[model samples]
Target: MSHTFDASVLREYDIRGIIGQTLGPDDARAIGRSFATLLREAGGETVAIGYDGRMSSPMLEHALCEGLTSGGCNVVRIGLGPTPMLYYAEASSEEIDGGIQITGSHNPPNYNGFKMVFQGRPFFGADIQKLGKIAEEGVWSSGSGEVTERDVMGAYVERLLEGLSGVDVGELADLKVGWDAGNGAAGPALERLAEKLPGEHHLLFTQVDGHFPNHHPDPTVEANLADLRALVAEKKLDFGVAFDGDGDRIGAIDGEGRVIWGDQLLMIYAEDVLKNHAGATIIADVKASRALFDHVAALGGEPLMWKTGHSLIKSKMKETGSPLAGEMSGHVFFADEYYGFDDALYAGVRLIAATARLGQSVTELREAMPAMLNTPEMRFQVDESRKFAAIAEVSERLKTSPGPDVEDVNATDGVRVTTKDGWWLLRASNTQDVLVARAESETKGGLERLMAQIDEQLSLSGLERGESVGH
Candidate 1:
């Protein structure tokens, strides 16, 4: 039978929507049928699936399993866990050909969605759009495939611990750190990880609760990190690391309770990863700080700036053979000694190991970074039809006029303009009807000038930087 999905749920990266209203079991079933058909056609027979702690997750998972089996795809149910655990199960298995994780990924409790992997590669972009077409066409393969449950959490935790393989045990023993799971899907995995970790660990909200009782699970927003900062301060821990709802993205605080932003975290990872793989190519999103690129270059590694989005970055990592890559949104990917997927839990372990190996505390590493003034990612809602056009308009204007002090324009994903004062970025968010803007500078006056350029660009596009939009 033909199925129709809410157009909004078919996003650039994953299928997502507010529960009941924009999405339901029918859509999940349709997705399962469509995805399974695709996998089978690509010479795959089995698909691994997992879900988060959301109240509606189990229902969706069951429906999805029904659809998968009907489409002649065996289902390996990994039960409740973070997205990375599902990735781990899929990546570590020789029999599993694809995986899907039912997760909202730092969104509100009312929201839920799915992230998929196909043949060990990200299943997104046109692949995500193809699901909608297949569902509408009602061309799913037919069979009653088997379904079985598997517990991969223990094995997943063991793999994460490998991030600290070479670090001195004595140094890790002296470490004291705080972790705030924020009552998201990462809670159970975090608990299991903390138990095995040698450092004195203090955890907050490790009990999985999709309602996000303590605070929001998104660590990118400083406001959501308040609880984590307080925990670090109250306990006098060495530092703190937090996971987003599905534990694919990370947010961290130093010993002094200073927020170590995503790009800053990459600087640390780059330094550590560069030791053995000197002159390796390191990748970061266009939104990352210039300091990170400069730092990577200083460390004798090639710095590559890429478009944002985890799937895009992961694909790029494979294309370029990059050992490590990160985004300003805290999605860190390590292919050095592990699978090239974003795993916040593994990133936290690497943070511990990096500090130990770098011969510096997290606070000291933060202190070593160059001080640059920057604005938090500024997101303003725009009409979906107007978002990309606005960026295009800005790019077209810069090509001809380029105004004063415009040095270079890199339109990799959007337009990043470099000027003497600093640089500013204007891009349309692929997942939402919003235009994202950010600016950075070494001097306060320079930062103000860079921000003005952003405002000027927006004005030229007949748009004002209006009320900030929430992710």
Candidate 2:
């Protein structure tokens, strides 16, 4: 019964791979049996499972169920939905103790993966590695556990509407907004949400087409938001919101067709959240704009910067009891009155509520932010063996002599260097064989200086910036 997985599919955060080559039914079943064993050992029996709209999802789901039942782990199949719906099924229930979502999550159509939650916490990093180890060792419990289906789509939509609870409906009467689901798993949920939401709504590609016939589902890339911006502009809507493939990350556009990066969106969310939970801690990844950290401080809230990766951020939120947290990559978590999971659908609803509560348009909120010149996240390939070592090399050099302008060096995740001009970050991507770099400064000259510093460090490590790599 021993099975060895394609090593590449076992990632730091989740199990993911190109469909036919690195991952398939065998891997899915291994994951299921291994996960079930872990859950049962922890005194938990029920596991919730859901799948995205990807073409291969159903097949994987069926095989996954077989493995789960074989291990004596009861399975609650929530059917096809976004990753958050599965999160909801697990979080909103006392009966379920763990969950797994079959989602590629903004990756290309040919890719698929699994995101898991154990007990109430993110099952990642060491947990993921352990799952792989258990699979390879072929140690699994045996029993026949029942499988049943539960429809939570309607309840999930209703739960999202709660984000707009306190807002005045009259203020929303004339509001016109645009939505682009990008044909991912969030499409159907978005449709149901829009019908119940107040205001005029224009939806683009709400049909769940795994092919992504329109634009790519990822909203973090500005190019992918072209259709969303056009929809907002043509309809003259108040604003627009977009979702990644599995609906865990969010991207937004203002009424003026300006793309609001993830950090800027966090600024708005921080203000709204701070209004209620004054002096609460708000967390963002190191890659977030300095403006966001500054804004949180200016609003009289404590701002904490932490490592990237959704699982890491979620754990930090629990540790600090942070009400809200976000990543520059568009993953936002709200623990104030909801579960502490990144839910883009809920974020969209909060955007509407934030506008109404703040008494300003989305564009106005965006316009008020400090103007900072920043580079789009730059990723360059490095040998998998060299990625983390390269970052350590850079950190070591900075620690020895950070130069005059360098204010401080934070190595929370990787190494983030702060200079009087601004800040720059160089970290190894947890899930990829690449180094991610981002720099931000108030002036164009300052930005250039910051970028130069980045290059100098890379050159010191015997590595050039090289051609940029795609996500």
User: For candidate 2, lDDT tens digit of each residue in 1-471?
Assistant: 967989789898899998999989998998999999999999999999999989989989998998888989999999989999999999999999999999999889999999999999999999999998999999998889999999999999999999998899889999999999999999999999999999999999999998999988999999999998998888899899999999999999999998899999999999999999999999999999989999999999999999999999999999999999999989999999899999999999999999999999999999998888999999999999999999999999889988999999999989999999999999999989999999998899999999999999998889888899888
For candidate 2, report its TM-score: 0.99
Please report how far candidate 1 places residue 226 from its true position, in Å. 1.3
Off by over 4 Å in 1: none
Query: What's model 1's TM-score?
Result: 0.99
How accurate locally, in lDDT, is each candidate?
0.94, 0.94
Clashing residue pairs found in predicted model 1: none
Clashes of each: 0, 0
- Cα RMSD of all models vs. native, in order, equals 0.8, 0.8
